[model samples]
Structures are given as structure tokens and as C-alpha cells.
Target: MYQLYYSPRNASAAVHWLLHDLNVPYELIRVDRKQQQQKSAEYLKLNPSGRIPTLLIDDQPLSETAAILITLCERHPEQAKMPALVSPDRSKFWQWMMYLTNTLQNELMVYFYPHTTDSNGIEAIKQAQVVRLAEILTLIDRELSHHTYLVGDTLTACDFFLFLLGYWCLALPQPLTEYPNLTRFMRLMAKHPSITAVNDIEQFDLDCDIFTFID
Candidate 1:
């Protein structure tokens, strides 16, 4: 059985959702961020970066959400969560996955944790990120307007990654539902059994109409 060290609603949720989608046996070990448990020596040993998720497979630990996600998808190729090596969609998959993790997720981190930057310019940095993030969302929404999924019709781990990012946007001053194409994509993904399971376990109300504005 795989062992996953995670914190609810963290980047780990994407991996958790994939595990459920793959229907694989896995154990969840919560690293309580509230108590700084991720920085504990024991947890750090498994993940030197002291991140929320460190998946243990075959007695080896793996960190980094994107790497972990690709590993899982490759390991369970029968599920086809990652396209085949020679598949035409393969390149597109890599593109969006990197864009989601490197571009979008990083900006979101800055938006949420502005203190990570220069103390005197935290507000300015965060406001700049807001404008940049809006542009990123527009690109994603435009892409979704062309295809049912990020890469194409077939759902991949990239979609799950997108879902995670969209979920994070719930805390933004402007709701994610404002983007119609993104909202449709999110609504479809929100109904998936894997996503539903993860949401229930994490206690996130992402599968409902919570995004609808209260006029």
C-alpha cells in the first residue's frame, strides 16, 4: 500500500484525488500544518523540503506535487491518467501540467503568502500577482473554451491539478465562477467521483454551487 503524508486542501489533495481515481490502496498520514508538524524531524526525513505531501511508494519517498502526480500516473498506466508516450496529446499534457504547477501555482503562493517576499513591498507584490493571476485564469478559460478538458476530451492528472488551483482561488476577492468557461470545467470536474471523495475527506464544499454569487 502507498503511504501519503498530507494536509487537508493542500497541494496534496490532487494526489489524493488521483489515488482515489486509480482505485489503489493507500494510507493517509496527516501532517498538521496548524502545529507545524510538517517541519518535524520525522516528516522532514521523508520530505526534506518539509512539504505537505510525501508519497511513499516501495519504501521510497517522493515530494513535489507535480513530480508525485506524474509518477503515480506513469505507475498506473492502465488508468491512462497520463497520456501514452507516443500519443499526440502527450506534449500538450506536459505543457499544461508545467503551466499549472510552475506558472499558476507559484503565483497563487505569492498571492496567499505575500510575506514570503520583501516585507516592505508585500502588498505591492501581492497586488501585482493579482493582475498576473487574472491573466493566467483568462488563458486557462480560453483554452477550456476550445476543449472539454485541458488537453482534450480525455481527462488527465492535469485536470486534477487545474481543479486544485481553481479550488485555491476560492479565497480570492473575486470568485472563480466569474470566468464562465472555467466555471463549466470546474463544475464538470467537481462531479467526478474521485474529486467528490477528496472533497468529502477534506471537507471542501467545491462540488456544490457555492461559487454562485449571492446577489
Candidate 2:
């Protein structure tokens, strides 16, 4: 069985969704963020970066959410979590995956940890980042309006990655519901059995939707 070191609502969330979606037998180990367990000596040995959602594949550590997702998909093409490696679809998948992580997810990191990026006027810097992220959201909302899925008609790991990022966007000033296409996408994804399985384990209050705005 695979093992994932995660903290609630951290970047590890995407990996958690992937494991559930594929029905892969795995262990979820919560490295408490509040307690600073992620930086503990043992965990640091596994992930030199001391980040959450490190996957142990046969006792080997794989850090970075994007890398782990792509590796899992490549290793288990039989699971159909991603496209065939040499196929054009795989090329498109890489495009979305890299864009999601490097572009979108990076924005979120700055938004979440502005202190690390800006030495002064953290709130001002954060608000600026939020404004920038809003533009990114609007762009994705527009693209999502035309495509049922991010890459293709069928769901892929890219969608799962974006879904978790959307989950993090619950704090946005405009609210994700304002973007009709994004709201629709999140609502539909929320109903998936795999997503619900992770929700149950994570203790998220499903009674209230993550992005708000009903139907």
C-alpha cells in the first residue's frame, strides 16, 4: 500500500483525492501543521523540503503534489487517472498540470504566505495578489465555460488538482460562486463518489458547500 503524509486542507489534498478516485489502498498520515509536526526530524528526513503530502511508493519518497500525481498516473495507466504517456492528450495534460501548479498554485502560496514573499505591508501585498488571482480565476472560468473538463471530456488528475485549488479559494472576496462556470464545475465535482469519500475522511462540513451558492 502507498503512504501519504498530509495535513488537513494542505497541498496534499490533491493526492488524497487521486488515491480515493483510483480506489488505491493507501495510508494517510496527518503531520499536524499547528503542532509543527511537518518540520519534525523524522518527517524532514522523508521530505527534505518538509512539505505535506509526501507519497511513499515502496518506501521511497515523492514530494511535490504535481510530481506525485503525474508519477502515479504514469505508473498506473491501467488506473486511467491520466492519459497515455506518449499520446497528444498527455501533452495537453502536462500543459494544464504545469500551468495549474506553477501559475495558479503559486499565486495561492503567495496569497497564503505573503510574509515570506513581501517583507513589508503584508496586507497590501496580499490584496494585490488577490486581485491578480481574481484575474486568473476569471480566465479559468471563461475556459471552463466551453470545456466540460479542463483537458478533455473525461476527468483527469488535472481536474482533481484544480478542484482542490478551488477548495482553497473559498476565502476569495468575490466568492467562487460569482463565476458561474466555476461554480457549476465545483458543484458537479462535489458530487463525485471519490470526492465525497475524501470529504468524509477530512471532516469538511459538506452540509455547507465549499464554494457556496446552491444550484
Top-TM-score structure, candidate number: 1
> CA lDDT of 21 in candidate 2?
81
- RMSD, one per candidate, in order: 2.1, 1.9
Per-residue accuracy of model 1 over 14-47 as CA lDDT, tens digit each:
9999999999999999889999999999998999
TM-score of each: 0.94, 0.92
**lDDT per prediction?**
0.89, 0.84
Could you tell me how far off, in angstroms, the CA of residue 45 lies in candidate 2 after the best superposition? Answer: 0.3
TM-score of 1: 0.94
**Candidate 1 whole-model C-alpha lDDT, 0 to 1:** 0.89
Clashing pairs in 1: none
**Which pairs in model 2 have colliding backbones?**
none
Ten residues in a row with the worst lDDT in model 2? Answer: 204-213
- Per-residue CA lDDT of model 2 for 29-113, tens digit only, reads 8888999888999999999898888999999999999999999887778988787767677888888899899989999988988
Q: Residue 60's C-alpha lDDT in candidate 2?
A: 98
